[model samples]
Target: MEGETKLFTREELKCRCKRDDAVLIIHNEVYDVTKFLADHPGGEEVLLEKAGQDASEPFEDVSHSSDARALMKKYKIGELVECDRVQTKNSFSPNWNNDQSQEQGKCVIG
Candidate 1:
């Protein structure tokens, strides 16, 4: 359809795991990084290791810089089908302590 977003299943994603054709799932979004393999700063091996699977944890663990994150948009192809989607860190907001009492007396002047 005109405005519909593409969706992919796990099995379909698994079939694309190859040096010539790779796909990745990060934060529920699908990315076809096949063309990027050779140019990746971390090297093709790192991306290949997570091919056809969810790389959200490892991807987030690296804390990719804003530029890296923005570059990923070019590789995005689709999203996982609803049934194959998993909860990702971006799905929720962390509960940070808002109590004023907790902020008291933490700073010291030498």
Candidate 2:
């Protein structure tokens, strides 16, 4: 954690996103997570739901769920400041519902 730092602030996220809905990116490329969060092994709301907002709450609120860690590793939805990692658009439209719940016995990861 020596180099660790807060990822993004509400203002920063808002500014980066410019109020738009978009996919998360680790490096470059479109990261088209738009339709994937719904199927993410961890329940969608964990990250997919808060798509464009400050995800600090859910990250800590659901600490007990391993899905948090898992999601972090795979998608690497780093600290709040990750908004700075890539450019954002103001399409801030998140589904938040992560409707994959309806799938039959999907057994979403922790």
Please name the candidate that would achieve the greatest lDDT relative to the true structure.
1
Model 2 agreement with the true structure over 6-73: per-residue lDDT tens digits: 34333433333321343443321123344555666666555555555444444455554665445445
Model 2, position 71, has a per-residue lDDT of 46
Q: Which candidate wins on TM-score?
A: 1
lDDT of 1 by residue, 1-110 (tens): 24777888776777788999999898889999999999999899989999988788889888899999999999999987776665554455365343324221222222
**Predicted structure 2: clash tally:** 17
TM-scores for every candidate against the unseen true structure: 0.78, 0.34
Clashes of each: 0, 17
C-alpha RMSD of each candidate structure in angstroms: 13.6, 15.8
lDDT scores of the candidates, listed in order: 0.79, 0.41
lDDT of 2: 0.41
